[model samples]
Target: MKVFSICHVSIVMLSIIIISTNLMIPFYTVVAAETNCSNGDIVIAQSRVGTLPSGIPSFSVEITNACARGCSISNLHLKCGMFASAVLVNPKIFKRQDVDDCLVNGGSPLAAGSTISFKYANSFQYPLSLASATCG
Candidate 1:
């Protein structure tokens, strides 16, 4: 009797597992595709020079949503000269704590195919006109 009962229980459990696995396949596929946004990458990278007497220039760069679907843009870094600066090289420099803040406020969370712009002050102290400006 004990052996029969154990076997019966095992069969029931196996059926449940099989049913669940089958039901999950379709759901999993949809979820996976939804998570995969179209060509996740920032599209635009435009820079504008700030007008200043001290030869200080400011720049703004944007990242689109396509490149940031499931990405987080935090601790944004600003590289004006040939060498990258460690101090400004942070992902959390945005003024607000959202995706758009990375550009207007100082935060970075440009969503997939979404446009996120960032601004940096280019002064003699920072040296924006050095040669290159990179953001990481």
Candidate 2:
């Protein structure tokens, strides 16, 4: 009788452990599925590279998608007020939309861990801030 009781208690404990683990699996899966990218994940790095023949300082801008979960971001817009460059920027890579807005990557999705770079000639670097993005 004593051996039977011991075995019964061990079986009950094992069953509880298994049930709890199973119950927690869905919770973890839900959290993983909800992981998403945001505007903050779009990193923009600009630096002075050199000078142009027109006596203007040249700058290099690198935009990167730093999504931790391999998410993609699209339709990236930046707050670029009166942004202009003596050096021509590829319209497919970056372009001004309005007085205070600019589009990046031609409104296409930038994959996770990917970067787009462009050069511009201006007196000072534009204070570009992420305006918006669509994450997927």
Which regions of candidate 2 fall more than 4 Å away from where they truly are? 1-35
RMSD of each: 15.6, 15.2
Model 1 spans > 4 angstroms off: 1-33, 37-40, 67-109, 123-136
In order of appearance, the predictions have TM-scores of 0.35, 0.74
82-114: candidate 2 lDDT, tens digit per residue: 999997999999999998789999989898999
lDDT of each: 0.35, 0.78
Model 2 steric clash pairs: none
Best by lDDT: 2
lDDT minimum window of 10 residues, candidate 2:
1-10
Range of the 10 consecutive residues with the lowest summed lDDT in candidate 1: 1-10
Quote the positional error of residue 48 for candidate 2 in Å: 0.4
Compared with the true structure, what per-residue lDDT tens digits does model 1 show for residues 20-122?
Answer: 5564322211211223322223344657556545555656655454434354333333333342221253344333233222222253344434555556554
